[model samples]
Target: MRRRRGFVQFAILHLLKEESMHGYQIMKELEERSNGTYSASAGTVYPALQELMEQQLIELDTSSDKKVYSINENGVKHLQNKHLEGDFWVEWKERMMWRNSEQSIQLRGAVDRWEKEFRKAMKHARGNPESVHELIAFIDDMTESLSKKSTKQGDRS
Candidate 1:
């Protein structure tokens, strides 16, 4: 369930919101929290940290071994802005489970089950003439529902 690189940025922002952590700490936290689904590779974490630092979202804290990072006032304000943006919370929730192993396994299982179901449905719909129309309508319905949900959720935010 490794997420896209965009997720790394969001995850870092959320992590900073919780507490200041070093790059390595952030990586470990992400892996531990998401059940290993998001092992923020060093290549990804370090650069993101640098980016955040540049953006004034975080700053280096005095530490002995590793440079600890803590969210600055700007960071909190940034997070609040993201909260107002609507999808940040949902994305954060989805990313937060990286800490819980059971949740991660469950998510993987759900995805596998969905893939199986999709294949089965495709097989069933292979021949029938009405199948194409049904599939199209189903896809349209799903897109519409998702759009409405996103819009409604945005308004609520």
Candidate 2:
């Protein structure tokens, strides 16, 4: 999952606004929230936290052995002022929902099997022009068939 620039900083601020958390907790929460798509490493997360602290958007508490961070007034103000919450979160939620659907799961499995078979056939058909042409034709036909089915379904809708 490639995120847009500054997305990590925005996500960190958003998470801190909810509650105080340590570095490790922040990493895990991000992973869980993204449906295990975005895994935050210590190297990436810690630096972002440090940058936020420097900007005074968040505050670090050193009362306990482990450092915990929470969003300060400036952080809340920045979030509200920027109004950057809509697109990223909405897209994430929609993707998660779509990926979890039963139809999506079945389609993913079928695609995986098709890829494996395609690779095996390609290996055997290497250096054979006729075999390669047949493979390309098969792909083109399948694509046309699926497109027509999709178009018909859209017309019915």
Top candidate, metric TM-score: 2
Write the residue-wise lDDT of candidate 1 on 8-106 in tens digits. 766787888888778888888877766555556898888878878888888897756779888888978877776445555455556555535687779
Off by over 4 Å in 1: 1-6, 84-157
**Mind giving the per-residue lDDT tens digits that candidate 2 earns over 51-123?**
8888999999999999999999999998898865456666655665677788989998998899899999999
User: Could you tell me the lDDT of residue 115 within candidate 2?
Assistant: 87
**In model 2, which runs have C-alpha deviations exceeding 4 angstroms?**
1-5, 85-88, 92-157
* Weakest ten-residue segment in model 1 by summed lDDT: 83-92
lDDT of 2: 0.85
* Candidate lDDT values, in order: 0.76, 0.85
Question: TM-scores for all candidates?
Answer: 0.51, 0.54
Residue pairs in collision within model 1: 32-99, 33-98, 33-99, 34-98, 34-99, 35-98
Question: In terms of lDDT, which candidate is strongest?
Answer: 2
> What's the distance in Å from true for residue 114, model 1?
25
